[model samples]
Target chain A: MTGPDSSRIYTAALLIIGDEILSGRTQDANLAYLAKWLGVQGIRLKEVRVVSDDMAAIGDAVNALRTSYDYLFTTGGIGPTHDDITVDAIAAALGVPVIVHPDAQAILAGYYGDKLTDARLRMARTPQGASLIENPRTKAPGIRVGNIFIMAGVPAITQGMLAALDGVLPGGAPVLSRTIAAWTQESTVAATLGAVEKAHDGVQIGSYPFWRDGRTGANFVIRATDPAMLATVASALMAALQAIGIDPVDGEL
Target chain B: MTGPDSSRIYTAALLIIGDEILSGRTQDANLAYLAKWLGVQGIRLKEVRVVSDDMAAIGDAVNALRTSYDYLFTTGGIGPTHDDITVDAIAAALGVPVIVHPDAQAILAGYYGDKLTDARLRMARTPQGASLIENPRTKAPGIRVGNIFIMAGVPAITQGMLAALDGVLPGGAPVLSRTIAAWTQESTVAATLGAVEKAHDGVQIGSYPFWRDGRTGANFVIRATDPAMLATVASALMAALQAIGIDPVDGEL
Candidate 1:
């Protein structure tokens, strides 16, 4: 466990479903949260797709993302609307039957009591053999089969469920980061940024363009799996910005 | 002149490129904002994907979403950085080569005046036969080729470009929504929500779970294309929620 190359980066992909998402009625919040969280875990979110609610489209997408990445997470279309077809589509993608599990029904029943019915039970119907994700938001319970975790579309709900999944999921190296917003143009520190990049190929350096109150600036973010490497890169960044007479917000934050 | 058979729904797909988005360094703010905006425009954001800085991955994603959805929008990886490769990928997907567009170059040339260099000139690189979308965020412009609209990944920049594109985009109908949240459990409104769903088949009516500060509630969101229909469904929702002893937000906000 105490090896030199202890940082192992796991990979993930997201499959966003729902015609509402594709039709531009809804913006996705889960993609960013999932990507960021995974990154910090030394798990890379390699790809993401927003697709329609059509079963065939959803099926094809689920099949593709599931195969491509080590873990595949999906959001949207798990709602109680007529257009909520993610469950059927996912099951179809796996060529499995969409059936209600005792555990899932129990999860819903604990909240709904006797009010749970045929349509309400539809939420409990996941692909056979898939485990249920406890949806604290609705008690509808998302499903996970193989490497795929089907989650809610709502930002708060999806993120909450993902947080719960963290305990059970085995993650890669925990990713730590330090970002400094510099009051300098990117071009001014471009050479120094290039130097840091060339020196530490494993560490990723990104410069973001920012404008506030008619003033333009750049946010330099340095990320890596190694804590010491991050410190070295960050020191270089601060030195570069200072050398160019540009101040940067310092410290571990 | 309104026809009963007119299709009221529209759809869009999003592809996010850049190792940053994939690695979770940035939470994608565009997908949510774009979703809410498109919802107002009667378009649903159905599918979305995030890919690494890899050109092959980006190119494959571009071709896939572009072929499947009515419109495809991409954010990130269009910058002047070395990792910025969206343009090359777009060109590759379309079976074309990356070439510097004179019009785009003119925009950059005007922005920096005499400071433009070969590295900065990289921003001018665009796919053949593509129209450049006006970028209000940075000097580099986003390109639109066929159905796909390529834009920046930064929230403010992407949103600004989206606002500019809004003027010329062909929209089917504007989607209107009204939400009512109150202290009530989902079970308490399940029956009534079902009734609302049944009565307003043309509109989408669903209940979302909400919990804050030891208080629990449901957010009932009603969405539809027709103004008259939206009003009717909203009125019914008010009555239904109020009937369940859940107070309305003072005459439909």
Candidate 2:
């Protein structure tokens, strides 16, 4: 249950908005991208929430999560469709007025000439003081207000924007990890594992079970703030596993 | 964003409790599996929440989502580990005492004999009057009370217990779907797509982007409560795509 001691860790939470996703019509692809990417950069993903596009629900969720966490990421319900209400929800959450982003309108103006009707321009709407996140997926861009970034639900669009912003976002100290995919049961290595955890106070040891090509095995990942300490525990773990007649494949994950 | 319109549509939310996941030490596979499965059966996955194994957070999330949605599902914090506080959280949320389940105790007793110490036996604990969901992954089971179903975060066990409880639970009418996939920019057929959507009042026509092996395409799926309407709209969508000289790939998502 150990988390990164973020004296001011750039903590983030995700609030996924869409009834299509909630109804399971669309499988959300943003959670893993955010979680894994944030992990490497040391901006620990504190929490994640997936909610329907209902305005009340969305407003309540956004306000609650955004106020609590340092950063809040919202995906979906910002498209040019009747069901898209993320803009309204964001404004409602902040008790501000929703208005069209002049820059977003400019982005679309060049592409569609006069063909960009009211329906299409609807995507340009944003809450007060929100900045646009340039989207390569579609002309309609995502918006960021304070630390809350609202992005498209589509995986490609979300991933694209996140990649573009990853290096720029203020981050906590980066984490380093090493793992050994060991062919053994968890119980067999429990004692040594406990000792390793006890010795490395700053590191967290996690064991994940995976069925590899029809065979059952476990991946023992030792993570730490310090790379040197991680390697030390990793070396000890590999030796302990080998001593117990279990072969481990060392790899970085 | 159109969820199934049915009184039987059981709105469910997930409260995932585990620092292992939040710390990026674990990748949660349960949320998607449960969400997708529930969608097919017409049980709406209203929300999903991931929080660390903190008693206060877990308790708060359990109380919140449970009150908001028709059903609540929790995972990851009910284990033999010392940090597992799902039982305590559930108790705190429900304002009830947690007691050991006889069924769970029997299951654990058969496996561990005298080795089933207090730490191990702790798995038997559940909020008062809650029923246990049998775990195929481990001896430690999950609990359910007042529409809240708590299960292990591990995929196999969650799926197994969900399957086991399928018949006992009520569900909305299953959603019927029809899909058309082929090479077409969503913008290219926006007008016609909108027309199709307007005509098919009962059916929902959704355009999804797909790129595989460098070939770009879009999958337009028509979903509705009525099977015949879904088929009709799907056929019309295919005809329109073909009429525009757009060759659609063969498949459904």
Candidate 3:
């Protein structure tokens, strides 16, 4: 197994909380968004768990992941509804009380005016001593409780909150990647791929098979912390595919 | 916290294994498909975890989830490629040795004929004391080892394997659901929704908010094991929305 250099590697875990996602009513959009963003920031997304809108589950996952990773992010259950118990759950996990942030109250009060009901006031609540992540798309800001960053369930709003959080966390060297898509079956070139991966130091190759236009093929993704080795791996992969009489495409299909 | 009837409610946890999924290189299609399929089988998908294609991580997740739930389903890393180490991981988790099942070998032989290469033979491998889940779409079949179902990463192949294993697992009650979409923001009617949910027994209302065409609204999903309670809860939710002067639309908008 190819292991990361532990001393410099930054990692994160995302806890996606919602019954809608578990019930198949909603497809989670935040994982991919956060994964790509973290990758660019040179922080590896280590694990992702989608738990239902249950308090104990959320609390347990928060406690487990927050301590295990460099950073922990949670999406969903921050809304102004009965099921939105993320704040309470995190407080329980952190051994703290949920408190209303005056700044959050002012933001919601200005946004909704007379419509700022008690339910809306729920959005201002967070674990004690926690700061806030700015929600550029809405009045309710995302809560930052210790290492955990709790954001909205809505994709657009989560994106805005993530934007506000860009370049905030420290990270290591960004993972460099190059994709080689071949119009040939992956199994046919499996040994070649493995051999190439073994020959290269500090490089990992991932083969993703897909069926498109009534044809089956695979995309070889070469990833490494060192950018210089990516070309060597790519060239070897292309040559290997060609040796097997496959025409490799430069990018993903 | 509302606990399920321990004797009757069958729970499941999915461990999606792949570096591609963790790297955000591939959008997972198996979790939702399996969740809905398992719901129809009366099994509640309680939790889902996406882990990288690493041995220790896969082994830990398989061990934890298999013991925690009635059944555990894992997708990805079952293909005939270098990254496909799900079988080996599961075997180590079960304290068993990796072996090539004769039945699986025969099945692949029949499917691939003379084209069954050494790489293709990798698909015939599974843990000892395991049965095979038929794959009508391709040569490689899914493995059923103890409580864990090891499946392919490819979406179509995974679907075929799932279809083959459908109606095979013992389950309790099929959860029925009804959705009521309201053109009002969720916070405006959050209190009423919670009240309606509290009044209803054996029913769970999930509020999913969405913004479309400059309009903000929410879809309230009411779920219950009893089909009769679904109608009752739907009517009450409709009445609640109406009392708040918000027009509720039938089904999802």
Candidate 4:
């Protein structure tokens, strides 16, 4: 437990804040993008919570997840509207006061110029002592306080903010994966997958079954931190599937 | 806080269990479908948690959510693969022993006949004192223990399970919504939207902004339980947008 490798397992949680998402009116597009982006940063996204634009809901979830992971990120409810209460909720969660960040104010002022009203000025609010994450797509910046990062809900703005933070945070080894697919039921190869995973020390095999063209098929994704281990497990799994009279494809079918 | 309408404000939480979703290997198609389905059942999906297949992770999320809402619906991790640990994890969460549900066993046996092996038999396991939710598509039934529902990961299988559960659970008044879109910045109309929402009781207005074809636009979605109230709020919102000199469309742009 005290090994140096223990520190290599960095994890984060995302809190998606919007009524639109929970209402099924807006399909969330941020989770997969952030998950893949965090993977490239060697940080595993261990959990995600989608909550509506309620203060106590956001505050409770923020506190619960912020302490449980290496970092906590929130998206949505940071815009100028009254429903945009993320900054206030997060500030209350951290027992800090919401303040107008001068840098954010200046950025908004420059972007909007004469059109900047008090409503637009609401974008400058953040938790006390928080810094800003630049949004190249939008002038209003994202907020960062302690281990919690508050981002925009818009996919493109979120992407821009994520790009601004690339290689900025410390991370661990990026997890690698190899996929093997077959036009057979996952239940048919369940035992083989279990045995192969148990035989390997640090490999995880995930079975995703699908039905296409009136045929049942599955993709077996083997994930490991070490490239050599991943390659070895891939070969072993391919051999096992072949032995069962199923032709396995190297990538997804 | 105790009122005649209190009982009619039903709410639920969703727990999504899978590593494929957390790793970005698979985009979740279940949340939107379940959200809309639950909406039609008059259950407001209040919060959703997506966690990995790890036992402690799943167990913690289940307990945290089950007690907080009227119902808790979980999707994924009910398959036959070794990584399919939702049943055991949920049993641990409920502080109950895992038992082979007799009905589930019979169904799987009837479906697989001679092909039913040990791995396939694992689908028959459920928490002690659990009932079955019928899966019309796949023979392996979903599980219902107390207030928690354990359903399949596949979108189609989950849909079949939900169809089986139609009119089964007691729900309240279904929430209705009206959308008004305009080719204007959300910030430009944020104040008007806020005022309109404040004027209308029992209505929540959500502002979702978008950028398309080099122009910024936003959609205001007004939700209420009463159709009359919903229409009134929608009309007020549309008038407010128009007063701001933005042409409001009846639906999403």
- Across B5-111, the per-residue lDDT of candidate 3 in tens digits comes to 42399899999998888888788888889889988888999999999989999999899899999899999898888988999999999999999999999998988
Off by more than 4 A, model 3: A1-7, B1-7
Cα deviation of A187 in candidate 2 (Å)?
A: 5.1
Instruction: Identify the leading candidate in terms of TM-score.
Output: 4
Please, what are the lDDT tens digits per residue for candidate 1 over residues A1-253?
1223445556788887755454444555677788876765556677787776578878888888888887899888775545577988888889999888899888878877887766677778889999988777667887889999999887888877887776466567766677877766666566667777788868878777666787867777777778899998888878877887877887422
Complex DockQ per candidate: 0.36, 0.35, 0.78, 0.83
State which candidate, 1 or 4, has the greater TM-score.
Answer: 4
Per-prediction share of native contacts kept: 0.43, 0.36, 0.79, 0.83
Best by lDDT: 4
- Model 3's DockQ? 0.78
Q: Which stretches of candidate 2 lie over 4 Å from their true place?
A: A1-6, A112-119, A137-139, A178-203, A210-220, A227-253, B1-6, B23-27, B114-119, B137-139, B180-184, B188-205, B211-217, B226-253
Highest DockQ, which number? 4
| Per-model TM-score versus the true fold | 0.82, 0.81, 0.95, 0.96
**lDDT (0-100) at residue B132 of candidate 3?**
95
lDDT minimum window of 10 residues, candidate 4 chain B: B1-10
TM-score of chain A of 4: 0.96
Candidate 4 clash pair list: none
